[model samples]
Target: MDESDGEALAAREWRLIREERWPGPMNMALDEIAAETAAAGGPRTLRVYRWEPSTLSLGYRQDPDTVDWGYCAAEGITVTRRQTGGGGIYHDSHGDISYTIAAPADELPGDLVESYRRLCTPILDAFDRLDVPAAFAETGRPALHDPACYLRELHPAHDVVVPGDDGPRKVSGNAQHRRTDAVVQHGSLTYAVRPERHLAAFADPSVDAATFRERVTGIEDHADVTRTAAVSTVEEALAEWADAAEGSWTEDELARARERANEKYGSDAWTRRRPGDR
Candidate 1:
């Protein structure tokens, strides 16, 4: 190997892949690739991406028929399923930024719920930076009965909420997928968009947007700042958190990610893979 190769190997490195803003499927596909890469031996990565033209993304387990296709299409929204399980989310450009964290499972807790709290702390710190009074929804029943991720009350390490006279308002929605090798946890940081759009996408006919908003709060709604400022706040907070944490993936690892992305994530079979596909 060349002398420079040794230097590159010795230096701690992390790959940052920021492709042009893509649609929902592309973003999810790339994140799956990154996770597989980590699983194989690639350095842990943080992929920040946006859905262009906006779209409504459903959790992997959710049935497509559950979404209001006509309503989404009329609003120029594209629909796709995420690798993670959760309710439908109407992603609007300029309203939110999404993050996917790919890392080895060894670095996180064994229990899925515990892992969520640990990962979400930085998000709480970001809210603290904004001076927003936020806390994780307490763990238990209320958390489970709420079908929509954003609608659920804070759990030990779930979403963030701003306490109010009436109750808590959700400001973020996050979820995780734990693989044998790595974990990919992602969530949306709400910005300028209306929760009504997401509420409308739900198949449930009885839900009311006003009532939901009255209970839920986006980052923009909870903070005493501008939307742009909140976005920057989260960016910086996550960066700091990652920096203090030490770890790096090897080149061979990235190659594995490519293989996984192409074979699993990139394939229609995997993208459309359902509950019993295994």
Candidate 2:
């Protein structure tokens, strides 16, 4: 192909993949497909979704067995591994919203840390719209390896946090994967916490329920806005952040996710991280 033709093929698209409320496994699978597709040298896309019955997602290199699988299964709490690496997070069905962004590598400037700050602009904007004073952790402190996402605060760009009980606590969790062509980042936005489930699901089970809740505050806690309103606000903020680019998804993307899940996310081998790893 000619240089122009190659560049044309490489140009990314702006789209959104809105999947139905699904289990954790399916959700992770879909993200994999979307990331791969975006890396295939197409347009950038955003995916917004929710979980049914709630769930806990471990980081890709995390040990799935570290979580209370029995408790999760008994309560119908789905657990899955994410394509990005970090820590485990609890998805409250009515309390939090999930978002993933896939775009060409060249679309962003600087290294992974710089890209994280760039993507977080919209989230910071969303918090501003809600009148919440949110800021990114600039000091790159290493996050603790705990089941609770908020316990470990590290600055790898913008891990959203604000002053709250026990001082500043992370209100959102994010992870990123950059390939030769595309970078996909996904994260959890905390709105509510079922303390019991949160504590029980952890393999290391350390944080107290009250302390955990005290540390993490959602939109509802900060303002009069409900979770629904927060989600709507985030959507609008993200739309504006992308300069009015529309978000969308397709059937082909969903198929690709399932295939990737079967091969990567669903495997036990990919769920545990080695020492000194993220």
Highest TM-score scorer:
2
For residues 1-278, write the lDDT of model 1, one tens digit per residue.
23553343335334544323676666676677667776767666765567786877767776555667678779887676777876667777777777777777776679877778667766788889988788876643354224356665555566666777777676677889888888999888776557678777666645676766765666666566875666667766665656523333346645665565466544656544555555
Residue lDDT tens for model 2, 58-176: 86566655788778778787777776666788887887788887777776755777778777767778889989877875454344445456666665474777765346766777778
Worst 10 residues of 2 by lDDT: 1-10
Q: How much lDDT does candidate 2 score? A: 0.70
State candidate 1's TM-score: 0.78
Alpha-carbon runs more than 4 Å astray in model 1: 1-20, 139-147, 152-154, 244-278
Cand. 1 Cα-lDDT: 0.66
Residue 235 error, candidate 2, Å: 0.8
Give the least accurate 10-residue stretch of model 1, judged by summed lDDT: 1-10
Q: What is the RMSD, in Å, between candidate 2 and the native fold over all Cα?
A: 5.2
